[model samples]
Target: MSESYAGKINRKLLKKRRIINAAAGREPADLVLKNATYVNVFSNELCHADIAVAEGLIVGMGSYSGMREVDMSGKIVLPGFLDAHIHLESALVSPREFVKAVLPHGTTTVVTDPHEIANVMGTDGIEYMLQATEGLPVDVQFMLPSCVPATPLDESGAVLDYRAIDSFYDHPRVLGLAEMMNFVGIIAGDDQPVEKIVAAQAHHKKIDGHAPDLVGNDLNAYVAAGVYSDHECHDLADAIAKLERGQFIMIRDGTAARNLEALVPLLCAKYADRCMFCTDDKHPSDLLEKGHIDYIIKKAIALGADPIVAVKVACHNAARYFLLNNRGAIAPGYLADFVVIDNFQDFTIEQVYKRGDLLVDHGVVRDFPAPEVEPYLAERARNTFHVETLTAEHFSEHRPRGIIGMVNGEITTVDAGYSDRIDVEYDVLKIAVVERHKNTRHIGIGFLQGYGLKSGAVATSVSHDSHNIIVVGTNEADMAAAANRVVELGGGIVVWDGGAPKAEVPLSIAGIMSDEPLITVNEKLEAAKDAAYALGVNPGIDPFMTLSFMALPVIPTLRITTRGVFDVTQQTYV
Candidate 1:
């Protein structure tokens, strides 16, 4: 804005002042790009213009008079990329860590889902993240996590009701509700103590959706329910269907990188209207090696999407769809959020500007403060231990609780299945939940299968939903020793066998992610994953990812949360 986020221009007064001062003969242009072709996503028109930026806003954009200008001469200028869907804290610990990872790719702003941490620590976690990202190289706006546990089916750490959602509405950095993952409950007509959709509607905030593989009548009903956007489409047809229903389809490529290739076709002129790009959930390894939203733009163009179409998916459409009038374009009064490309192919970044200041030059964060955020949830690592039994009877004590199945890479999962109700003769399965909090001796036990290793035990504090310690074993002694080690080391995911732990990754921060640098952590985690492969665990499409979602009652087919088990088809706890 000429006056910094000013709503309306005092145009008549300014026009009079322009006559009196003559703007001091245009002054000296603070920065100028000479003879660059502007990729106007709004008009789909290519124009050669000399751009002048002053006071951080594009004060003049036209054929230039002789002015001080950087020699752009032949480079292209498109609006900087935007990540319409992503979770930054989930991707890495701090904003600088993430900006270091993706800024060179031309992504200058991100719409994040912080509901993951909010699920564990409630409002406190949300504020910590917000304070940490106050003045970053990129604009960091949050969509208040719609569901803290994500759904009422589980015992999530905290519940964010309508009032809680409303309380954050005017918070300077807040956008709207994060992806509303509970489509099954919404469609099944379940009215509990509170409805997330009701909160979004009352506050007039956008409610992002997460409905994977929803088809036929259910998909149509979900659209009508007033959830406006989704990033969970795995196929092109799914993207097209949701776009047809007026839901902005966020083509996502997170750690798993689904839908980047499958749905690039939707950026077709027929449907480019509602297309956008998102990272959804990326581990730091992926963020470091593979680019963020810029990687998607290149992939889409490589897959034959027009360069303009790809840029629109990454920038224009997200802004237009959500009515984020302040950005998504390089016009007057919009945020000074744009990128100056050094070159296009292989995409070398030159400089980045956010809120009208040069913050990143040649991919390095410039003049920014590193946030001093302490690991506040340090005690939760000790609380991770809970259940105290080792025998098969301990797991089966409560009528065979739900077992999680995972299919690596795919985000959704198969429903929770029943453990065979045997006469206690055969060694079938056992599962455990290691509390990553300060309960080292506590372990939650249950029975499960599908990893196909009942003769041995597979243990991990990476249990989904509550992030507690979960181990599945045939022998009580093996399960006990494996679960005990996680508590001993504070918190981590581990696997074990008869006498010793096979592999482990200590995650001291709320049991979900590590405060340790991701590269160090992912290397160890991958080593453990490789070990699971040697033990006959099928990776790349195994029961791990599916098991995490098994507890998520939001996605269809079936899911299980920290609760006993959710019958998503019945929209009730089984």
Candidate 2:
């Protein structure tokens, strides 16, 4: 029979019949996992069951004969983890390589906001991410980026207005509008943002939110505008308030920001269903050393959270919030996605099965064929690093009373007291943000006090919100060399010392991700970190990741952009 004609037949009915036959032992199942202890999220209990899979759905969860069977003796079977929110671009690897890195860690699903790419390449960037993630072992879902440039205060490479955003509403992989980082616009009832929210609602799609420290009437107004979820809460009070206001809170535990400790208290039985886990931005080093949602689960358990509730927060809560009804639970008719672990406490994933196919075995990811990269994607490599000229003079700035701040373990920055000059004695350094998108030759110069760089410089084109080139250094010559080197590589992170490149990780893909494998990317990142440490950067912070956030103008207190130093509290250029 022709494949088209065969597909046109009642395949749904035939699949249902097959499932019924397999469960009834009249037909052999495609795969059977026997002698396993299932962590049933639905009932919040453990059950010894033999899982029978037909096609790609759970046909039954009892002793059954099958065409193929694997004895999962003494193993604990849990649903595959779902990362509620993440930025795949932040991994510094393409979606193809990112899947390879996280599959062994048991992350089978991810809902990603491609705003980082959208800010750089506009709608074309969003489409590229969707196309790249097709047919992967992990279930990659795209959340339509709500804010392309993030805010009107700064310029991005491309703009995604309501008209441009509406085009992806019907895309099969599009879950909803991404985190609306432009909370200021939404609170003010701006026409552009308000219209986007209405369009998402009209299409019955959920809208994610990104309001950091938003409270009082403003928070109410922001939520009232139909923004449904938030992943930026850093404390318990804000988390409690958002939960009370009917917003699903994504407890984030990533390399830069670690809020899981403070928010773990909120993951109690009372709010277990409303809380989910997300790594908003995690580098490959962190993703590999510490697992994704699996890491979050381990931390939550260590913090005295119930093991079952922690698992629910990692798996069930995310699935429920995203309306992924088919894969969160190990029940009949659900998608056959399982994470086989030794126990719930340590959360050591031994094997992972997606759609009845084993993808990870013995804690190592089974190699799956990667999708072909279209030739047009290679064309995007040119003209990304558009900086014309960068010099030591660009890093010179005199602000006796101007103060910039840095916060530990958080993206938010605070103002340290003003300084008379670049006080290298006290660890103050010169920070510059160079505009790379339009070759505007615009550079924003300021002083940062916490980098601890006594000499040399660090630079990256992976700046947040607006992916400009941002560099910080003790000496202007090193700063100039580092910034120019980043532009030279098209885009990536670089650390320089003694007026030469110390270490570099090239992210040639839209100047945000490397086309290299995850292992190579991780090695480069580690070397970059070592170089930063050698340059006297504070060991407490991930220098490259921290430098990336310094350019984010949306975060509070003080931030630098290509336009100028922005006071986030005052919401204007200082």
lDDT of each: 0.65, 0.86
Model 1 Cα RMSD, 1 decimal: 5.2
lDDT of 1 by residue, 216-276 (tens): 8998888888889989898987877887888888888877456788887787888887878
Query: Residue 1 in model 2: shift from native, Å?
Result: 13
TM-score of 2: 0.95
lDDT of 2: 0.86
For model 2, what is the alpha-carbon lDDT of residue 375?
67
TM-score quality measure for candidate 1: 0.82
- What's the residue-level lDDT of 327 in candidate 2? 81
Candidate 2: where is the Cα deviation over 4 Å?
Answer: 1-7, 10-13, 396-401, 408-410, 416-423
**Per-prediction count of colliding residue pairs?**
40, 0
